[model samples]
Target: MKEMEPWWKRSVVYQIYPRSFMDSNGDGVGDLQGIISKMDYLKKLGIGIIWLSPVYDSPNDDNGYDIRDYQTIMQEFGTMQDFEQLIEEAKQRDIRIVMDLVVNHTSDEHAWFVESRSSKDSNYRDYYIWRDGKGAQPPNNWGSIFSGPAWEKDELTDSYYLHLFSKKQPDLNWEHGPLRNNIFDMMTFWLEKGIGGFRMDVINFISKDEKLPDGEIHHEQGYGDGSTYFMNGPKIHTYLREMNEKVLSRYDVLTVGEMPGASTEDARIYTNPENQEVNMIFTFEHMNLDSGPNEKWDVRPLELVALKRNLEKWQHALHEVGWNSLYWNNHDQPRVVSRFGEDGAFREVSAKMLAICLHMLQGTPYIYQGEELGMTNVKFDSLSEYRDIETLNMYKEKRQQGIAHETIMSSIYAKGRDNARTPMQWTSNGGFTTGTPWIRMNTNTSFINAEQAIADPSSIFYTYQRLIQLRKIHAIITHGSFQLLLPDHPDLFVYKRQTAEEEWLIVNNFSEKTNQLVWKECNLPQTKGNIMIANYDSPKLEGDMVEVRPYESFVIAFERGK
Candidate 1:
């Protein structure tokens, strides 16, 4: 008999970046009601999970990652009642709602932070990490992720507090027992309310070095690399295990951690099943394939061979023990079609190619909003139109250092998080809102909207829908072993998934140029096969050679040992 697996492993996830999904009240913000309104649309896509981005009460600092309150819904998003209604609506369609949990830090305006900063002797004094300044400068030369010092001094207590992201977002002190208990209680509150699970944001950074020692400084940037002391810290595993014992073990739910810089060694322990820290984690190794050492903003051309090796490594690393969360686009990433595929002439074609290439891999697939419609990145002429804190800060810093505006804008165009935050193109006028949109809509919406995709049978939306359907029908997609066919192939990504009964060959042409595969060159077996899916209409494998068009891909299943 075959062993049973969890629902999440076999299920596809659809991530809804709420601020840009839809607006029910014409308020230019996507609300819970907007999500409720679109329930049927998500249902039609055949996804089992809807990973909703943060909707908790916030000042919109870092776009809701800085939570002011955990339980209350953001006024812009609507009330807790609306959220509850959303849960019921989603449940009716058999779709579970997984919330985005941002517990590493809280808004400076939060009640706990307010009280904690009032005095060193307050009841909430130890709620956050606060330290004394070194004479006039900060406690250390740590850098904020948004391009400044990580420490922000509070005049009230005459001390400095650590903030890994923004100054307004203060890092919590997990060393305090009470704070940990409070977090667990908050988690239980949500679990009881029927949330399926959590997508923990920077969850690995919750713990920190108590000594708060100075770190290695970079002279060019004049900031210390303090991530060494915080990321995957000493107490992180203990804290997560405690969370599992207290809150998670009671509920049957899915949990995925957005862990930056997580190595496969760390993942083996995190998702080893015996440890039970989390169900899976999103690693950045593959995501950084197109970036250089400075940052993700330091854009570079991606070599297809490097990508194959990186993903193949992860596939084998976790094949036996851990699970991987497969995704090409997310709330914080540029659309994959634009970044990796030919978004100009072969937009939809390449979109389908990317979807099949990733969905065939061994992992739970995630489809970001507008990805199904093959949304392209925006090239806004000026920086004033940008709302992302990271983009704005980078532009300002680079300009001050005498960098050309065009050069900085080029980086932003290639890698800005806002690229994924564009309002969903429901229509030519952006049916996302009747009134003004929170951000500018992509001009391509005229032809690339959901209304168009859903109407056309050969659209990217149907490609994704079919991909999800195929996953449900084929156990080979979930449990089959993966093998890279041509690791040195420059333009082709050839791989196979095998089971006891069959093998599936997935060949993708990642470039715009057509490639000819002479069967004998790779020593691959020449077998009569069944085409499961393909981007092009007719992709026939003539004897001894397979000619794939630009961005063409297909999966052909054949009997094992044929």
Candidate 2:
């Protein structure tokens, strides 16, 4: 089979949480104009693609995830003309636009769902899942991702409808042929409107098991019985292929599936070039490094070796068949400097190190909003202070279970969506916007805002600028293969990137103390370069090997002849 083009091979995608990115209108929320004003900044940063989060018309139940209309831009975000202008402006700067496609479910207020729930025999009724109760109880013991039972009883229809997330967000019935076609039509509509592709939200969840059997039960939280039946189901490929053939294949669109529970093998079926279903799938395996087997909410001191091992496993497994979208933070994730690095002290050094560690690997790097500035999570004192639906629901769930208020508050501070959703810090004069921000800005804005970072050459901003340039300039870093070097390093993270012509060793000290690795065992000759890029003030090269200072990182260019 001919090799299909991989989007991650040489791509640089920038994710924008539209509401918090910038507020052009003084309505205390970001709109399309805000993004337009910042186009030059993204273009200057060398961003190839801009992945805009949902700006569709919505009830804001899930903050635009619960979309009401797929065709119209949300009034709060501005009109269709504004979105078109933004797209035109972005394209002029050579940046492709990718919009969020939250097709897993729609708000109950959506015309289709609203009509579906109105009557039993309505044409739109089959558009959603409606089942009879099990003798006054739900169909099964499945739990919603938000909290409580996945099924919500509707008195008007005398049936329980399925909602995997918030009750207002009802799951769509993909098995229905007409409903599937409608979704395809909508997708085609967007593609015709100049959208490069979609960032599929929970695409794997769209295909559930036909049987709807209950999943394995858990102790504290109830099991998602329906999820086991539905997620990565037998008919998933059939549905995806249909969409690909009818809508996606026609346009040179890029699709990245935000798949949560899919295995590497399963993901390969969806993303492998031969499969042709999608360009890539975002896996949560590495992101869940801090969580327990059951996904406990508590924090565990990060295990770097284990993290490295997991990443290496994936890199080796998919090196040939599929591509990985390298990212440490996204809108749904806590800041990388906080979660992966020592965000409090020595943050500058560790932030640069983490950036080098991920960016130097063989894959496309996704830079989340404010990530280049080493942004940290905001500290909120109470649940009331948070605006995210997920965080608020978790707080309530924990509180009802008799968890201490302080304990719940601490978890919110550490794991809340609001952590990543906070407004981007642009300047010190309330860096986010002219009017008050929709959400409070992180207090560290005073010290870590963008204007200062951009002006200072040694700041994380410039370090990232160099990283992007390196990727753009080096063929090996973009298309070469990766091998984990010295996987068992105690305090250091080391890896090698190699192509036919050259090999580059990337080493970094992820801890507070200095560390050394003897490269003699690896049989690689001592490397030499004019200090290509280093995070520390000074790196001492003693004879053959180099010692890395606390949280320092370096990418030393090497070649056989030199």
Candidate 3:
């Protein structure tokens, strides 16, 4: 008999960037009470799981990612009681809440970090990675993801602490058994709070090479690529397995690790069922395809062929061994329509097309907040308009290097994280808050708001709802075998998902130019099956040929040997 699939495998997850989602207390910041008020909205969208970005007590250095307290809720968000109520309210609507677990690092202000930095002999000193630096330089040439050196000196102790991200966020020492246990205890506290699961933030980086060797310098920036020493590090599996056995195994919960530099081979071990680590992992390969040779801030056009190749590699690699977390937009990514599709002329159609292209695959689909409304990237004319640390750092670094401001702005337009953090356009103020917002809302909110999308049946929001409903009713989307079709086609992303009894042909025109689909190339019969879903008003299907309009997408279901 076949094994039963987990709930997460069949569920469609919606990611909510808490700070920008909604605000209830008129504080110009979104809060837990705001999320409680939007349960019905999420339910209407057919979202089964809500993967909320970090809402724990934080200094907002990385927008809640730099967690300070594991048990408390951020004051700007709400009280712990408000969070509990939010969970209960969501549970009533059958929407499981998945908390963002940021165990890899903590804000430097965290009690442990404060105590650790107080003295070299402090017991908590080992709780974080602290090393004596060479004369005046850092122990190594590693650079932080945000910019500058990854190590920060503690004047009191005359030592440096590792921080892969912002200096305010210091990396935890997973090598310390007590530190690992403390993390596990925190997980248990949340699991016991009745939360359904966790979406671990850069969890793979928790473990590191103990030697702390210098990385090879690669970029025009003088710092070395330290990802090799930290990301998917030597003891990552051992750490994850321990995490699984200690806290995760005791609960029936969804767990997906955010692995920045992970490959398909690493995914095999991280997500394989027998390994008892995580249910799935979010890989950055496809997301980084459009990134230029130097870094993400270096502007580059989207290459459909490269995107297809990377996606196919992941889909096929984990098809049998592990599960995949499918997503195009997340808290850390720019808006999908603006990045990969036409956000001006054919925004709705392109958004729907991109949705169909990803959702039909054999993996759990994740929809970022506001993506259903065909949200485009924010075009901030001035760098001061940006809020993300990474974006600000890149802007500063590029300017210091004497790179043209226009060039940096163009790259920010395409890949800035702030693009995804803009207030959810619900009304004139995007309905995100009654007062002034922390960050500016996208000016397109007048037309692209949720209120407008919900009223229009033909809008991208409804299209996403339909796609999600189809995933629930169709087994092929969840467990069928995936095959890439028209691999050589430059403008068309075509693929097939097959099972023993059913087959699905998913064709997407990725470009604005109309393309002719030679059905014969698919090796299917002349008889057309039912059109499961399509973005355009009407799709043309003739004998062994189909006319695909600009940014058009369709999924056709066929029976085997029919």
Candidate 4:
């Protein structure tokens, strides 16, 4: 008998933000041609899957997330033929393409939304959530994730529509059977085109509470947290099961849902193979460890205790029945090296440390573009320099509340989405385009660019390549049991992975100060083990004590019971 292997189990995925990845034809924006040109680069990096952010036709209100048409490609991204060519080129490199699926909402300019709002009695009117306001106010005090009332008034219909995000993006009504069929049909259309799979955006929020009711106010501004009503709502599991049975089951592909506010309990059910909902899930609990008391915009220093607790909880909870999608940097997040590492003098070592710390865990790891090169956060001098709608809206809200400008700007610098959306540093002007870039290029490109890192053997890029190769061939890294050690250690993250024949010890010093690792506490033999990988050239391993330098990381493999 032979073992059946899932392609995603040992594969490493690299996420590309198309608009910032590269630009072809001097358009000052990235396109499919640019991605096709980078096929060799991704292949050399040892990435098997490429997760590209949405490139569907849109009004560009919320970037390409507000899809205007699922069947068509965004004009800025090039034609459908260009995309087909990209798929072909990637296939030649043995890389699979996974698209961003944003079915939660659509742009107001979408044909369905335009017709749904055209008249109260339109056939498509029921395709969206609509309600008559309680007098002049909205139906409820629900707040938008982008910072305002969740309801938007439509003068033509004399009703308010639910929009959890920007007003230009109207939420879809999953209660309508025909609407769900439409979504499934659209998904099948792309799957049949030879695309690998999908990375569903805000997928858990598709279902909502049956009764529309006011929520308790959590912020001083009087807006309520309506996430309880929509996030992981009553019929989310049912919808996912239906999606799986209808379209996903027929194809061998990966499906990962971006689920916010989801707990380990919810994840077990959402991703359990028996349930057939999805292959894995991307949870935000670990990412929110540094968030302030009230909101994500209120930034604070990352705490080791909270970070370890959240990560270990997910790892243990999903070890038996479900899977995890590991990542530290994404389009919606700040750069990992800047957020949790020393990005100033020790950038290279810290970036490598963060990569090994996350990649060695028992999950499919995702590397955001520019992350392997140790990209740091952009330090814009003024709010006018920012381009993200979420950042601009929050700035307006904070300014109106009599908050100090400096304080608000500081928080934005620490938590803004733009910190990750900046153009990839390739060369002067980031090599993103010949013309002007859509967003201002980070000035640090002179030193932090890929052109420089590719030439340096000791750069973060090379370290990441080796880590990816390790995961591909190491059985323990893929299917071993994880046990977190030194849970109380403030600066050192230590863990052990054990398989039937091999045991591995992984240690990472995430701070700028040297940390002593007492091997006696590890309960292993005093004999040295094989050094599988390490950020530094030589790490000292004394009899009972090992001195880990600032931002040092290493993985040692030993024969079990040796």
Candidate 5:
């Protein structure tokens, strides 16, 4: 008999942003049945897991991130029966459903919050963080992630409630034992329903510093910084351990925590198997490489070296201790082709190159909806066209500060979350819905739809499909030791993945200009090896100096099946 490894270890996860994926009833909002309609497409793409973004009951404050009920499905998304059908249908195709668990906060309309705000003496009053104001001012000068103050003063009790995000989404008090119990119960209920796993949303931010002190100014840039208190808080690991004991440990579910502001050292402990916290974590370090130090909206062109160093840091850090969730685009991020790759004349090749770069890493790869189709970011003409709360707030604030409309719109085009929220492009007209979409569609859908990609064998979709297949067949890819080949290469991202018997050299040219790669100093073989996969036809690697073409990437199998 063969020893069984964790199923999630070998699986590729495909994330579905329900609102944009597909709509079955022509309701303009993608729902459970819409996802079910695409099960065959996902299976054909070879993803073993589908990380479904929140379909839970919500008021759409931040899309579906703000939840009102744990078990109930959103009315726009359909009923509980539809959700059950989705799970059953997905499982039949060897695909497991990993729900987005947003326990860090809940909608203000949640029953617990409704009762907690009704009276200071209510049983649920302690469920959320509420503090008396400091005289006439807020208890602390904390700012919400969305914008402005983090605290909302309730007139009923004359107390200010902490909300790290939007005011309508109140932060839950993890210190409360009963609150913890309720969270555990919710997890058990889902697991018992036959769902495969959970993708925890900002799980690290659950435990906040009890003191709730005033925020300090940024060291490098002048700005108020409030993330210091709640990010990887004092009691986070303790709470995770308790959560593991109460819920996670009993089930063989794949657990991934979306941890922002988590250092490499912090992730090592959070995902280390022996610690019994989570299976892996999504690190934002790589994603922040393009942003200015002061803020995410402060967009700066990412240097290839910066991205290389950031990814190498995480790959090397978690090589022995934990697992990494590899991704370039998600519902909250701009499309990778637009952000990191060439989304112009070289869009297809560049998208394939980017896929090779991420898929070659020693981590579970995640493909966001339409990512396989090489989706590009949308640049809307006006603020009226945008719907994201963060982008709208930034535009309003910047305009108030006398910033030019072009300047703010440029930032919105580069880093706005709305870029990722656009309706999925299925056709030239965006067959996402029969009716108008909830958000604007990427106009590039005319040429970059999934319909066209699936028809072409040379498309980015096939490259991702082949990459997923490689993971299943090649043991070297799954558990191989990673070594950065050219640590300081300006335009080339080169690395080697090796097991005890096999070695593979993965080369990527991130620049539009052809780069000359000299791996002689690195002691790599001078001989050209067999190409396992590539974005370009007849890629040349002659003698010592290899010329990598514009947005080209390929894996050279020097040692295989030994």
Candidate 6:
């Protein structure tokens, strides 16, 4: 059995955006108590880990990513006691909690940032990047991840400070030993407090490109190669290895890095089981399918071949060397059904099909809140209704550049973070909380809430429940070797998971039209085994051929001696 490996590699993780999960106090905001109240539901869903979004004390500049204090829960979420209670309750149900660690930068209001900004000569000033502007302008034309110039001029200190996210999130000078030590100490502090590991936020961006050279300017966008300098730098591996040695190695914890722009080779380096920096790192190659060469947000139509190719690349590339964090939806992505499948007309069928495609594959499956019930994107008529800082800044930047409102709206509809940040729907009343939620709930909450999904036997929620159960029951899906069966099928996505005992053929109809699958496509004897699972209630099968419905998904499991 090869000892079955660690639980994280085989477990199912669920992400909860605290503000929108459930509002327990009726204050219109979701809190730790709200999460506590929902434990039994998560337990039933078979989630092994609950990767919670940041609930740390913050000014909410980047919505809690800019932390003012790393040790306490934000007032909006509840007290430290409340968080501890949530942890206790989750443990009772055997669900581990992974906290969000936004370590790349800190809020301008943080004591460290304040001290660093007070005077260039201050001892803490070395904690942050402070440089004289290039002749009254920014040091370079490098742009912020959010928008505009990366450098912010400090009138008090007469120096320009670098902020990759927002002016409020000043980039920490990780090159300084004292600042790095502070970060390491904070991580250990939380671990000592009975907390599990972390979901590191853009942690690779800590090491900056010291040259700060403004590379060849992009025609429309001004910056070039800045991310290359800051992301996955020389010190990144050193810092991560040190953290593993000092903190993570001491505890049985799960760490997933937000390593944006990481390639397959990078993943191997970061997650090589022998001795690597972290447990796993998230890559963005698959997530960038819709964007153009410019990497701006654009909703290009998704091609099944391209999607399958990307999935196969990562799945096969990391099979023996590293592991993958398999997911299609998260805090930054829109609902899977709405973005990847038919949402309105074939919502139920398509949702189930998408889930089966990912869940049965070889990797850990991550289900974001409300994804099981087939949540859709919010339909906002005006940009004023948007609350996300990144979306708002992009809007402002485009508008200033003479971009039309419709053009901005088109991008928002296709690629806005608000699509995923909308409140979770508990019922048709849109009452994610008793009071008004900080962000508006999506309108479809009326029909697609958790209450309704749990009641329906064949709903996407239970479909996922079964799929996850199947993965656990069948070790082949968990750790078996995978082989993509048909590489060039236009409307079909097919693959096989094989182990010494059993071989499973997984097929998906990635289209809205019917497709006929020949039995030969499966490369199995007709009487080998029974159908394990299917998205459609009654699939049309004739002897050696199977007729698939629109967005149909099925798994056929064949044991060698069956």
Residue-level lDDT of model 5, residues 1-108, one tens digit each, is 956878887899999999999999997999999999989999999999999999999999899898999999999999999989999999899999999999999999
C-alpha RMSD by candidate, in order: 1.3, 1.8, 1.1, 1.0, 1.8, 1.6
Instruction: Please report, in order, the local distance difference test score of every candidate based on alpha carbons.
Output: 0.91, 0.84, 0.90, 0.91, 0.90, 0.85
The candidate, 1 or 3, that scores higher on lDDT is 1
Instruction: Report the poorest 10 consecutive residues by lDDT, candidate 2.
Output: 521-530
TM-score of 1: 0.98
- Tens-place lDDT digits, model 4, residues 164-266: 9999999999999999999999999999888999999999999999686788897977888888899999999999999999999999899999999999999
* Each prediction's TM-score versus the true structure: 0.98, 0.97, 0.98, 0.99, 0.97, 0.97
Residue 422 C-alpha lDDT in model 4: 89
lDDT of 1 by residue, 1-562 (tens): 8666888988999999999999999989889999999999999989999999999999987999989999899999999999999999999999999999898999998999999999999999899999998899998889998888999989988999999999999999999999999999999999899989999999999989888777788545789988889999989999999999999999999999999978989998898888989999999998999998768888999899999999998898888798999999998999999999989999989999999999999989999999999998999987888999989998888888899998999999999999999899988767999888898888888898988888899999999999999999999999899999889999999899989888888989999998997766544445777889999986856787888899999998888666
Clashing pairs in 6: none
Model 4 residue runs over 4 Å out of place are: 1-3, 525-527
Stretches of candidate 3 exceeding 4 Å from the true structure:
525-528
Candidate 6 lDDT tens digits, 16-122: 99977888888988889989988998998898899999999999988788999988889999998998888888888988899998988999999998888888778
Query: What TM-score number comes out for model 6?
Result: 0.97
Candidate 6: list runs displaced more than 4 Å.
1-4, 525-527
The superposed Cα distance between candidate 5 and the true structure at residue 76, in angstroms, equals: 0.4
Better of 2 and 4 by lDDT: 4
* Residue-level lDDT for 335 in candidate 2: 88
For model 1, what is the C-alpha lDDT against the true structure?
Answer: 0.91
